[model samples]
Target chain A: MKTRQRILHYTGEVVLILFLVIFLIPLIQTFFTALKPDIEIYKTPVHIFPQHFSNVHYLHVFTRLSKDFISFFKNSVVITTVSVFLILGLGSLAAFSLARIDFVGKGFIIFFISLILSIPLIITVIPIFMMETAMGIKNSNLGLILPYTAVYLPIPLFIIYNNFLKVPTELEESAYMDGANRLQIFTKIFLPLIQGGLIAAAIITFLNCWGEFLFALILNTKRSATTLPIGIMMINDEEQSWALGPMSAVMILSIILPMSLYMIFQKNFVKGLMEGSVKG
Target chain B: MKSLKQGKKIRDNIVGWLFVLPAFVFLFSFMIYPISRTFILSFQKFNFVYDSKPVFVGLSNYVEALKTPSYLTALKNTLRFTLWYIPVIIVLGFLFGYIITLPKLFSSKLAKIVLFVPMVIPISMSCYMFLFILNPQWGLVNSFLANTIHLPMLVRDWMNDPRYALKIIIVVTVWQRIGFISLLFMSGIQGISSSIMEAAIIDGASAARRMWSIVLPNLKETFQIVGILAIITSIKLFAQVVAMTGALGPNSAGGPANSTLTLYVATWKAAFINFDMGVGSAMGYLMSLIIFLLFGLNFMLTKSERA
Candidate 1:
């Protein structure tokens, strides 16, 4: 019986290692291909390493596609950064009020947030596109920014609300007694207390906005407004193709942003992501 | 005293409104208004760039949408796609996550990094990466298969063939998503106390027995999270399909024969391509209703647990 168990364990570990390799090879290969010269991209019996390793792809994108690249990159960065900023700023206040303040029908309002967050925005794309077109933001960055912020609002709001609820209101009450204004109390105490939750919320908000594709694809048709993902896809087809090298290089950098952000707050990001999922 | 209390309540209400006002403006402008107008447009069959005004006809647009073979195909394809996708993502994520947590090895950390790399790369990046990798000629997949396994181009023109296009979408989606889901599961597994596993081991129970009886049960809560993510991600499945097979799948409306176009993608064309806002709106609403019920049940059940 012990021998049989040992055999099973060895088999499982072996299989697991094989599966992990299979899963990661494509990604690793893509990174390797990024260093290959553009012309060598489709070479058969593909070389695992680039024959003539080139930084040209990286340099080309930075130098040649600089304006378009920088603008689109900025579009993603500014929208993601600011939306998260406002979402946290407003979300914390709103979450605080809901968690602490006595109000009529608080349960229903909180319930609404839950419902809103769960409903996938895919069903509402038609209406959203129409609204954007009408607002003259159909192919504009604002169109992308506005809806992305609204649709994702429930998440940060929910996190902040739940985290706030866990904080002992006794502290806030004590602050109230000590003559700290509500603003002062929030800025100095509550803000510092929920910093982890806030960071997690911000990271998620940023990732969602940055990785957003569908809305960007539909709303931002012009080169000026399109995101890196959409831009990459558009350049994928046809001659003068951005080539596999630069494409993958840009993709690698794009990935680094979210990867680093996620790593910076891995625990909080994961915890916050799973917040609404696990409790039930 | 009554007036003062009412005034303070009003002030709080104002503050509340102010707080949500930014999100509200976005919701009203983008969601409510567009949805309402789109719903109205669906009732009117407007030809794109040709018809100035859509003629108001009730339910005809839906009838038209349903009658089209492509619509039926899209429904079937999406169902089939989900059937293939959900299981792989769920099983692979859970299985790989379990293995990754085994007594830390020399390469476990490096494996984790590589496993997660695919996730951070945007869907567009994956789409392009896979395109080069999966190309029928001189593509990495075919070459690797030919040289290593010697399969003699088991797949050629994958995107152009209806049969294979869906597979490509499913494969890419699974690959792109598996990493993230696995990482999520790894964390879920970590949340379980090791003492229980250690306890089971000390008692001389087999690893399989312990996993089936103990670890699986503890991971149920996390499984629920994965379940919701899977369902939500499944319905909104767009980028992978669009990126892989082009505008609508290559052969058909979704293509290789309407094989890759999902409900969301279909709704997209109906609005943007066909300019039939009403039908698109109705489709969107129908989709939302369907997804809402699914998500709502899960949400309520989760909430009820809280109660």
Candidate 2:
């Protein structure tokens, strides 16, 4: 019986290790391929490890590739930062109001948020495209940023709202009695208390805006306004689908920020995901 | 005193409205207005490139969508993708979830982190990575099979083959998502009461038996959540198809004989590519209708459990 239990435990460990290796193969392959000299990319019996490492692809992406590549990176950063800031600001305020305040039409507002959550974003793309084009904001970063803030609002809003609900009412009441107005209490007391929730919302919003493809694809046809994902697609086109090395470099570049954020704030991400899903 | 309290109430109302007004303004413009317009547009004939004005054509767009072969194919392909995607994701998710949560496993933390790496990266990056691995000429899979394993006959052009194209897309989507789903399931497993599991262990139940009789029954809510999410994800399948299959032509996504064309991709092609907004709008509503129906079905099935 003891041996049987031991056997099961060892087997499980082996399976897990094997699965992890298999799971990470694509990512590992992409990293290796990115570093491989251009000539080795097309070599037969594709080597998992690069024969000779080359920084040419990386250099090409950064220097030799058209000025558009740098702009794509910059555009992704600016758009994601601005949109996430908007989401956190508007989301936290609305969440605070819905969670803490007694007001008319509160139930209606809650229902409205949930309704928007259920509707998929694809349904709105066409109209948004037409609207943005008519408004002359199409092919611009602002076009994507505004819609992203609006569409991605409900999830973070719910997360932050639930966070506000978790804060003790006594804290707010005491602050109120101590001469803090609503804004003062909110900014000073509530914000610090639910810092975890706010960070979680920020990380989630950042991830969404960073990787967003559909709207970026449809709305931003101009090279200057394109985000990373669209830029990668454009790279595929510019390379005429043959230059895997530079494409892999761009892929690595696109993932670096999100990957680093995930490594650092992984706990918040899990917390945010679970909270959003459980409540949503 | 009454007047003062009433004044405070009014102030609170004003404050709350002020707080909510900014978010509502964005949501109304971007979400609500577009949804309502899409509804109206579904009932009209408009083409961005060809038409000067939208002519009212009530019910015809919807009727025509039901009749069009390509639209029907897209609908069929979406359902097919969903059918394949949901079960595989759920089952693998459960298995990985169960394995990662085992108390005796020393590497559980590492496993959890590694499994979730795919979730954090951009979907397009993953899809493109798979494209490199599955590229016909120099792709890793083919070269490895033919050169390393000497399985020359087994190598095929994966992305362009009609028979394999959709399946490969499913594989890529599953790869991107399975980690996240597993984590969700892991959370669900952890949510189960520890005492019940301890009792089963003391009673000398086998691990498989314990899992079946205890953990499985306790994971009902997780299954429902994961199921609905799978359905929704499968329905919104766009990026994977676009990235994996590559574009067949200008503004077209589903390719290699339309085998991988999904409703979402088809809608994009129609509205944006083909400049046929009417059919696209109707298809969008139809997609929403399918989602609502599925949600209703899920609710009904779970109603008894809740009660």
Which candidate has the highest TM-score of all?
Answer: 2
The residue-by-residue lDDT of candidate 1 on B66-145, one tens digit each, is 88776677777777877887788889899778767766453455556666556566776677777767768757777877
- Position A128, candidate 1: lDDT: 74
Give the least accurate 10-residue stretch of model 1 chain A, judged by summed lDDT.
A271-280
Give the Cα lDDT of each candidate.
0.73, 0.87
Off by more than 4 A, model 2: A1-4, A240-242, B1-5
Candidate 1 TM-score over all chains jointly = 0.87
> Per-residue lDDT for B84-172 in model 2, tens only?
99999999999888777877797777788898788888888888888889889989899988999898999999987899999988888
DockQ of each: 0.41, 0.73
Model 1 lDDT on a 0 to 1 scale:
0.73
Local lDDT at B109 for model 1: 53
Candidate 1 lDDT score at position B106: 38
At residue A89, candidate 1 shows an lDDT of 73
Number of colliding residue pairs in model 2: 0
Native contacts recovered, each model: 0.43, 0.73
Per-model TM-score, in order, reads 0.87, 0.97
